[model samples]
Target chain A: MNTKPKILIVDDKPENLKALRKVLKDLDIELVEATSGNDALKATLCHDFVLALLDIQMPGMDGYELAGILREEEKTAHLPFIFISAVYTDNLNVFKGYENGAFSFITKPFQPEILINKVKFFIDKHQQEVALYELNEELKNANKELDAFTYSVSHDLRAPLRAVNGYAEMLNEDYGTHLDDEGKRLIENINYYAKKMGALIDDLLAFSRLGRKEIQVSEIDMNEMVEGVLIEMNKSITHNAKIKIGKLHQVNADYGLLHQVMFNLISNAIKYSSKKEHPIIEISSNEKNGKIVFSIKDNGAGFNMKYADKLFGVFQRLHSQEEFEGTGVGLAIVQRVISKHKGNVWAEGNINEGATFNFSLT
Target chain B: MDYEVEILIVEDNMSDAEMTIRALKKNNLTNKLLHLKDGAEALDFIFARENYSDRKIENIPKVILLDLKMPKVNGIQVLQELKSDERTKKIPVVILTSSKEDPDIQECYCLGANSYVVKPVQFEMFVKVVSELGLYWMILNQPPK
Candidate 1:
């Protein structure tokens, strides 16, 4: 890898190219010189130049024409140029040079300091852009690796978990008469933990799988969706909470993902507020700041405000497993789904008071 | 190699194969079951080549419970080879693997797999799934003669 930045200097006169080289000699760069416009185009093909210094008074192809041709090429389209002109030093000619996409214009008998400063600016800008491009490529590769890891976990990790659970069940089934009560209890514990681990792996896979799933947007009736969630929850859970649902606005979003979001939020609200006597749960939506903000508020064991930021993180739980039986992936999944839709999710809570989970869809 | 086979299970994982056999045994469906270790061996046995050269190729199993991920050759390749062959094309192949990936499922179906079932992690669910699959394929399904 050539770490030194390349600069192309083009002029009709060899002396002029020499003068530009003498000016840029102090800078740490590789200079490629061309005496004609055609040669400059050829030089661009050979090297990825950070900046091009062009003389405007060439015979066959002038500086402006060369710059225009360079701009047309995809590789050199964004290449910055310093236009040097002895003939077109006037305001009109300078304006024409600027129209031809000149980064900086220098009149002939140009000061060495001025040329060096302008060359240095573009080189710095090019270096910054290169750094940013490298960073972006690294991030893309990292995301790909994470997805592959999650995929393997989904496929390979569950096999061992299934084996553990299966053998324990076989032991219990085949030798239940021979084993004592304590031995049977131990086998049961093994099965229980294996099942719990299986659930955790399933939740983790679901969360990671969301990253790769493409969003298919459609107009969803929020009222109907919430009603469906409530009906399903009522069937599965025995909760005595007083539920209230306000008019939810219809929004364009992925149906399956949004349904999951609603399910997670509403379920969290119900579970957290289950211990409260006469627990009150409210589900509402309204348009604010050109976004439909839907909220699920519950009067339950509200978390401390200090740890609110940690609520949506994967496996991040403010409450222990004893207080709430959860895998802690629900909110993380909610955040991922909402963010993928280009929306925002947040929560407000205080100790012993209540918690309100809100999300906005555009 | 010479025994009467009704169900052929091609699975590389010993534990998984054992559990599957136990599940089938519980339902009295393992009497004529044959378990091959990998796709290569399964292919050899089905084509009546290599070690099982004495077996007749015309004696096809009623159901082949195939695992997707295996050494030498995978389930998709096995499904492709079987479905493309005239003699083995009629045999029902049920893809039993741990992968629930959409692409894998789609590819299996595209390769002419009769069924695709994700292996459940829970022991009881695994047992139930295996037994039900055995009962359905052995009893309910009428194979082409």
Candidate 2:
């Protein structure tokens, strides 16, 4: 809904205002006339004008002071200025105009085309700058809204989820044997579904939070990180699985986001290996070019490599909800964390044999 | 005004209210219970004396169990009025809602709710919460005189 560009004519003379308005009447523009410098300052307070045409030799708090005040206000700091004076002044006045953040100085008894061209130039530039500023503000506001949503999910939303999980557990505990088998199964399913819903909400919140969170770039130890991930994995690793580690190296990245990448990769390795006999999982890190490259290998039931591109999409799970239990947010979280830290994550796997997931931080 | 009831459940869902009552009954705290189906009815009970001069309104419930997204007068409005009034100011109100929106929680607390609780989707966990709430508020907490 952007309208016509605005041009403010600051002068005590009504005829000059009307005449300038007449000259620029053919173009898409708005001409606002302020009789005195004080009036101009007051006018600028409300309306947004693209170019301010100031009469330099007018009354108290003249052109220069008005420009200075406009510059001081963050709201109007970048509003373009042009000094329109009908004075037979010297080069010194011209020099003074430039010093006061004036874009151009048009002399008295100026040609109509010259005034029109000069005013249009600053107006166009100002319009572009204003548009950019508005866009930036919109982006900031959207990010803030997302952040608030995440905060709500993490704190407020957890209440009902807790209630669901808590109450479901109570039902089974209090009257378990009294309830029929179907009823018991229903209650268990209810608990299972509630917990799964809670997990989804949490992962979504984390994904949204990653958008605004700052990334601290530094050298992170891949060896220590892999070990830490392995330690966390050990608790959940119930099967006879073997993890083979290759020579690891250091890489520049945000430690938290990088840790998230490895954590997800290793967890997925463990998750898909439930059916395999003596599941073989291998971890390796190496320096490729100037960037750090890392991979996780698993001898498990793998997905079709053709659909590998779809793996990192949000809520995209390769297997059915019944076959593999997941929120379908793990790899998506991994991809996002990697991307936020200026990295990329991808995988290559064929059914039955194995899969290799690798990423690079640039 | 002096309220003798220990738990005041303000809820619109009949099934949920029944489930909640069953949980409370299991813990043996159903005798002093007062259940209202809607926010408007709850408000009427709280400010009951205004309509019926002969029937005196009790001071306030020992603890008010509030549901946020109810018909007519919402839970937030109820909280605001209760907190603002000197007579009902001391009564602890807990917000129970399906919505986990931060704004709902903030608005509830901002209007002076004592605690916020979200309803679980699972019926069993909901029963457990009901049982814990019974044990906690009825047995553990010392209601204001």
Candidate 3:
């Protein structure tokens, strides 16, 4: 493995190339010699050079012309160049060298230390960029692998849970008359826990799936969406919360994902405020600072403001399962869906006080 | 083997197959139901090859309840084989699987699956879905003469 950095040295004269090589020999680098501009182009095709040293007094093509040609080609467009010139030593010539995309210019009677310093700078920079690119690729692969693992694990978990639930149901159906009261209760507990685990797995799968789902954006009427969500919630939940919905503004978002966000927020509000004497749930939306902001406020059992940051985390519940029945994945899913749309979610509440959940879409 | 088969269930999982049979039995639809353990046996049974060579190919089941994830050739392959062959293409194939997370559902429909149903984890829901499926396919749906 050739781990050494590569440098392309383009000079018509052999002694000039040798002098440049002698200066850079102390640094661990592989020097590729190119006697002409065309040869230098060919070297670029074979090797990824970190930096190029061009001599201005070449026969057919000057250093400035070579740098300009390299800039024209996409392969070597960003390849940094150091122009070494004896004849074109004037201020205008230096400016012309820069206009042709030269990083540094040196006269014939130059110190080797100055040239070495400039070359080292570019080499270090190129190495850093390569390292960063590799790190990014690795992170992407790890994320994809995690999603696949979560998906398959959650999927495989359901089969066993189904069996547990199925067998328990079978036991209850076939032996209900023979079993004692405690025995039947034990069977019911088994069934209940099995169903709960199934729900948790389902929620985990849905959350993991959000990472890979491509967001399809469409205009959604907030009023109509809220109405539909309320009707759906009414089918599953029985609550006496006096729900008041204000006029909402239409926004562009993925219809399905946004529906989930609304569903989770409203359901949480209803669930939390069900203990209130006169439970009141208010839903409203407005355009603020060039973004649409929606808020759902509920006069129910709210949480302390101290643990507010942990509210949106996956399976991070502030309350116990006894106080509130949740797998703690709803808010996490809501956060993911909103973030996927380039939106932000937040809340404000105190212990035993009302809470307001807000989300903004740009 | 000689009796006419109305519903053919191709599932590798024994518990799931038993539960499905139980569900079908509730609706009185299991009189002619036949359960195969894997996709290879299912292919052999449907095409009347290998171990099933003695069985006639003309005895097509009214509906096939196929599971997506199975050993020795999955449901997509089974669905493709059944849909492509003219003799077995008319038999309705309903997909019953544990997960809807994969793109197999779209591919199943694209390959001419009669219906795609995800098996619920809850026992009561599973029984309801499976029994309804049996009543719909066997009693209500009319198969070709």
Candidate 4:
């Protein structure tokens, strides 16, 4: 009776309770018995029950009144109640039972098979509701935990990375002459990887921040952003080639995020073109379908179109490590930036000819 | 051609420290070498007297090699501490790190790191940096003696 189901069986005769238990024992259910309506009402108040089998005839509180009281209480109101009256199956009794929150009626000389099936239906449905309720709460808590963890990573992880890079650089300058060529290069690589890892962390943080940061859409000058990106790009891109600056159009977008988009697209053009014989980079933007479309084309080691779907995936690189150098997050960041601005990004390329990236802001 | 440098090398990794020392030595400037592991140890070495009570305060190495990533004290905090210290206040601290992260480089300079150098991964390049640093800090420039 006090098992998993937490069922409340109310009947004046103990014989009826014993009979119901014998029939439902095979099903994994807990049965609780109350001889009178008063006892049933008291039991429902203290414990959660999947279903209550109420006896219509009772001494102090009648089944209808008790059921009405249970229905008034928010806690036990939704519990499925089955009324047992022994009184003939009359329309008035059934209508009143229905009005008082009785799910259905069961005659005193109950059919064991029919009762078992009906009780099983309600019990299974109740278990499902409970499972769903618990799952929702668990999911909410997990999301909150994840948010806190990301915040810690955004701040704490960077301190150590900075230290690794700072001291390594000092070693290079203060001890350069004393080291052999290979020795110097080793430290430089360490410095490089540390920087690479640092960029990875920053990109991850930026992507996470994008979810919450308010996107302030304003008119943005793509030409100016492109030029600024070019200046920054010049610092790291070890490439010598002809870069043609096309006419850029202004767009209604988040200025900072759009700048990031342009920077990523343009620099990617230069990086992929590092090995090109005549590396030519073209930047142009236009209004397409009422959206500002920006494109960056480059003559470089292009990727196969079959793998095009993976282009914007975080840390997804199609090329071998020896062929290209990057954190593989540039395109992903660009995608995020554009997506945040209510835009779309796509890439077109062949194996060796070149690659062209296009994005639009709406 | 000689120079006495108040140099601070802050480095966390030991192998890098040894390599840096080797490079500086090869450049013929091994008379002064101060190696501190983490930021906390570096601060204690430079600021607290009882920390390095066994060593002479006057003979503090002209250059301090500082590593940024350490358990307690990190490179930036150490730089801030050194710049603020009267005794080792003017010492030229160079940041040598394995990271090419821009913010790390920018922050080091902002915190008064004298020079920022990215450690090259290849052995040959690392040796070149070490030698250049030795030549620059030891033989080329003179510090306030």
Model 3 bad stretches (over 4 Å): A55-74, A84-109, A179-183, A215-259, A278-299, A337-348, A356-362
Worst 10 residues of 2 chain A by lDDT: A153-162
Encode model 4's per-residue lDDT on B1-145: one tens digit a residue: 1222244455666667777877777766766556656787666666645566455445445556566656677787888877876777677777777655567888888878777887665455677887887688666767656
User: What are the lDDT scores of the predictions, listed in order?
Assistant: 0.92, 0.80, 0.92, 0.76
Local distance difference test, candidate 4: 0.76
The top-ranked prediction according to TM-score is 1
Residue-level lDDT of model 2, residues B50-135, one tens digit each, is 43334345556677888887779888888887789877788888887776667788888888988898776566667678788778
lDDT (tens digit, per residue) of candidate 3 on A1-362:
23888999999999999999899989988999999988998999999888999998898987888999999999889999999988889999999989998999999899999999999999889889889989999998999999999999999998888999999999999999999999999999999899889889999999999989999999999999999999999999999999999999999999999999999999999999988899999999888899989999998899899899999999999988899899999999999999989999999998888899999999
lDDT for each residue of candidate 4 in A219-329, tens digit (9 for 90 to 100): 877778778888888887667868898778877888887788777887778778978778999888888888878888998988999999999998899987788777677
Q: What is the DockQ of each candidate?
A: 0.91, 0.16, 0.86, 0.06
- Please list the residue runs of candidate 1 whose C-alpha ends up more than 4 Å from where it truly belongs after superposition: A34-39, A56-69, A89-102, A177-185, A213-258, A283-294, A338-345, A359-362
lDDT of 1 at A332: 98
Every candidate's fraction of true contacts kept comes to 0.96, 0.16, 0.92, 0.00
Q: What is the DockQ of candidate 4?
A: 0.06
Q: Say which docking band candidate 2 falls in.
A: incorrect
CA lDDT, candidate 2, residue A209: 70
- Encode model 2's per-residue lDDT on A1-362: one tens digit a residue: 37777777888778888877787887788788898877887787788878888887776887888888888888678777878787836888888888888888888788989987877777667677878999999999998897777766665565566666666776787789799999999988888887888888878877777777788989977889889988887887665778898878788888888888888888888878867888988998777787777899999889998899899998998898777788888898888888877777889899988889989876
